[model samples]
Target: MPCYLGIDVGTSAVKALLVDEEQRTMADATIPLETSRPQDLWSEQDPETWWAAVQTAVERLCIRAPAAFSGIEGIGLSGQMHGAVLLDERGQPLRPAILWNDGRSFQEAEELRRFHPELSRTMGVIPMPGFTAPKLLWLARHEPETFRAMRMVLSPKDFIRLKLTGVCITEMSDAAGTWWLDEAARDWSDEALAATGLDRLRMPELIEGSAPSGMVRPEIARAWGLRGDVTVSGGAGDAAAGAVGLGAIDDGSAFISLGTSGQLFVTTHRFSPAPETLVHSFCHALPGRWFQMAAMLNGASCLAWAAGLLKSEVPGLLRQTEAAYRGPSPLIFLPYLAGERTPHNNPYARGVFFGLSPETQPVDMIQAVLEGVAFSFADAKACLVQAGTQLSYAGLIGGGSRSAFWAQIFANVLNIPLSRYEGSETGPAFGAARLARLAATGEAPETVCSAPAVIETIEPQPRLVDRYGPRVDAFRRLYRALEPEFRNAPTGW
Candidate 1:
């Protein structure tokens, strides 16, 4: 049986998976990469590091099962979205790749709103500093030498695609996050480019997410022990791929991913942002489809922080504290450890622990983290509702879903059941593999989603529903009350 290789360049690591046409995993490998924090509130990584990690992962996957490489029919790349990777005239990285989590361009983003109010109005959303366009503007202003030498701009995944096929290309799903895409038209927005003072000519050729870009280069093919003729498909952003992996492609079906960051994704046929600009509107992995997404800057990271403070891991700690967390804790944690993105877009926001006293124990901290993340999800869900997407329930994925306790907490707080898949929690790499299959076979994305197994369903407890209803309302108000403070606060990473 022919297999497809899916490469997912994530924030912390590069993951590669070999999957057969029927979606059976043959082998997988992950290589860790380091991210740099040069200053508080800034995040960056060398693009060369990502390439190295990808190369290592591909080689490892082949070693795990050499036969898998022979059956490899195609390759696809998915990655963290919204990062800016500038390449010079000679195709060398101009500087460290500004990451999706970086917040150094807020002042620049503000200038965009001031100078391009009309463009913002038409786009239906204002640019955040963490977005690609603002980062590019920052580079243009601060690094004139590098800016002058720039020949092409691409996201992290696009850079990898270039390494694989020697072609400069990007897909709509990733492009939609760049603030240059006209979400409605599914193409680069001329008005946005003119308003932002960016050169549209420098952008990579836009293609459908499933379109085949080119074959893998012979040198990389030989190094990784793969066929030189393996077709490379245009993969999508991580969130879109995650949705595909979870089989959340139909309207009314939603996918909630809780990784380092958290996002609530609602599939939609039309392009629309929430009236408050709390959620992002982007093209979906499915060609010509769109989605509205709300992101939380810190989700599982909050729990991870608490675990680090206690010098423990979340899985083991949660297992010990699960039975003890019966009701809400007095301690409330604001999970803005790295500031916030959705609903506020405030880069100066900092995490806070309110109501902490001598009585607050490790279990209390763990409970606070879980509740805080759930509260944020409630806020995101409200944005979806405001946009007229009535999502009654959501499919859950990621490390957060492994815990039955956290899943129940989320269900109770959101007041909706959580649906889960049975097999391995395939992340974006699995989704990319499915996309490659669709490209090769001409099968509809929805058709491939058939017979996805549901492992469990978590329903909200009726008794906790009334209790959490007011708690969620209070969570929303707390953010509003702290909005001014967050805007004026000193930077804290």
Candidate 2:
């Protein structure tokens, strides 16, 4: 009867899920979150808003299933990766947390890479504007006073853990993306800290994803109508957590996450560093596990953008695009609305609707947008394959996975089977819940982390694959041709 609560502190929302020992969902709740962009290339959110959102989300869950909430025995945390939440001595946030998509730290990233030439090898990634270390470096350079006052730095989810358990702790998977953790050693690297002008003193306690970090505060337990013995598990980064949710933890196990940002996540047994190719190699939520991820800053968000531009609901857009799903559309969308991460790593990149003509219809535009996102994932898959990560099939999870058309397109573009599992739509929150079940029952992850029953398997249609092959090629060439223009263009452009 014991249930677990998994909370995912996402970029645009806070999601809470309750699952029993058998991994069956008992209840779930979500609270929408808003990010602030005070300047170009900047994305931030008040850490306190995350705290409040968690409380509100949990309160709603309790209302839906009071008995299940009362039986909650453990908590797991998953969140947007690489976010920088600076806390003072009293554990209060010094400023708004910089998100994973924030690009203001590009200069700092370059400077850090220059100072630590071996950084890519050490962190298993090319230092980009979004990672946590660069954000810290940016703070040191531009906000020295605040940086000096910083007592701790935590990711978005760990910030919530601080509020829940009155402890400051982070796990390996999330830490791996910080560009400070040694992925091979599964610990914070002193050399990385030195390069960023940060010391181990400011870092939180490091634990593995499955390890118990702390116990819930008595007050929080009572307020949320939960048992006093609820333990907290070291959750994971959003992608790793989503992989965990899908039970994609073994070698060769991979998944495509189409959330606010997209990631082609492939699990690896060894510490695989693909820095030269811009592939992200990092630890998985579980111990002795590693994953390589190629992230795209824009994912399902592109569909949202299109919806806003066309003044249509997402469901309606999907409905309209059904007829154009496999049809030819001369238009191609770049899906660089928030810039790009994988392959290009160009923060200045802008979205483009190339090949548009007077005959183009709204449905053609929608089809192009979806195809563009799919092509971007195809690019990430190519990098992973080049890095020697062999993947025959992958699970699909996230808000975009609800679209069968999108799933089919991904399968065709990637030329592999894409499985959609029952309850996979919950994504990271459910993965966190599974981790919570592990912590609560001391169950072997193999027993508890198994993939849920697949509801459908999207196999690549040969004709569609052939159709997309040339278009995917064109997608790559288009980006290469536009790179120089993006670099030279003014900020206003």
Candidate 3:
């Protein structure tokens, strides 16, 4: 049986999966890497670290199944989007990559908005600090020597693709988030390049995500115990890949992913962001399609933080909370631990806990976190509805989706049904494998994805929906009231 290799370069780790043509998993390996934060609001990682992680994962996978490596038919890669990786003339990294979570480029992003008012008018969104173009501009202004020596620019996964295939290339879905591509034209935008003072020539060749870029290099093949000529396909951004994995290809279908961050994505045939820039518009993994995405910077991270504080008593706390709650609690939480992305792109926003009284208990805190995340999603859903996209049901995935309690909370808060799939991996690694299979055999992504059985469907209780309605209205008002304060707050407040 022919096999394929799928590599996902995630924020905290690199995951590799080996699967047969039928998309059955054969072996898997993961390598964790450290993210550096030398200063406030900065995140970076070494490009070499990604390559090392890939090498280690491939070596381990080969040890588990020698035949899987020998018969590898193709490879696909998925990774964190919007990171800026620069290469010098010799294709060596000029400096550590500015990660997607980094917020040092706020000034540059502001300048971009001033220079291109048409961006909001045409694309229906404004450039933000977390995007690649502003990061590149930040480097250009702060580190002139490094910027002068730059020969090529790529995203995180593109760096690995270069090491494997000796080619520097990227896909449209990833490029769309770079602030360098025309979303409608589906190519590099000369106007954007001129405004950013970047030469289009420095950009890599763009290709569709499912198209093969090149074959594996002989040296890399030998090092990883794989055939030299294995095809390497161009992969996509993580959100797009995750959507593909969950079978969210058709229009009107939605998927909500809650990991370190949260995203509410709806597939659409048109390319348009909300008029207020509440969501992002980008190409999907499926060719000739697009999606509207609303991202929340701190979704599961807040819950994890609360859980850590409670430690061994987490289950007990949850159970106690279940015992005490006669109905939805009166407290509300603003889950802006890392600031927010969609609706309000305010980096200065801080997490807020309102209606806290002496009577509040640990269980109430846990419930607040759940309700806070659900409230954030309600904001995103409102944006989608205002933009004329209708979503009656949504597929839930990721670590947060594992909780039946949280799933029901989301269903109740959103007043919609939550669907889940059985035998599915949580991240984009599985999506990359499916893409690899489709690339190699000309099979359709929809066909393979449709076979997964529905594991469970969580329906919202009427009482909870009625209770959440007024609270969601109040949540919207609170953000607006605090907007000015958030902007003026001290750094890291």
Candidate topping lDDT: 2
lDDT per prediction?
0.81, 0.90, 0.82
Give candidate 3's error at residue 346 in angstroms. Answer: 0.7
lDDT for each residue of candidate 2 in 1-493, tens digit (9 for 90 to 100): 8889999999989999998877788899989999998888889999999999998998888899989888898999999999999999999999999999999999888887787878788799989999999999899989999999999999999999999999999999999989999989888999899888888999999998888989999998878777778899999999999999998899889999999999999888889997988999999999889989999999999999899999999999888799656554678889998888898888889899998788888889999999999999999988998888877999999999999988988898899999988877798999998888777678888988888899899999998888889999999899999999987877754
Q: Candidate 3, TM-score vs. the true structure?
A: 0.93
Clash pairs, candidate 2, are none
- The sequence of per-residue lDDT tens digits that candidate 1 reaches over residues 306-414 is 9999999888889877878778766677888877888778878888777788878888888888998898888888877787777788888766777788999999999
TM-scores for the candidates? 0.96, 0.98, 0.93
Count of residue pairs whose backbone atoms collide, per candidate: 0, 0, 0
Which residue pairs collide in model 1, if any? none
Q: Which prediction has more favorable TM-score, 2 or 3?
A: 2
Which portions of model 1 miss their true places by more than 4 Å? 121-124
Off by over 4 Å in 3: 121-124, 273-275, 312-326, 449-451
| Model 1, C-alpha of 64: deviation from truth (Å) | 1.9
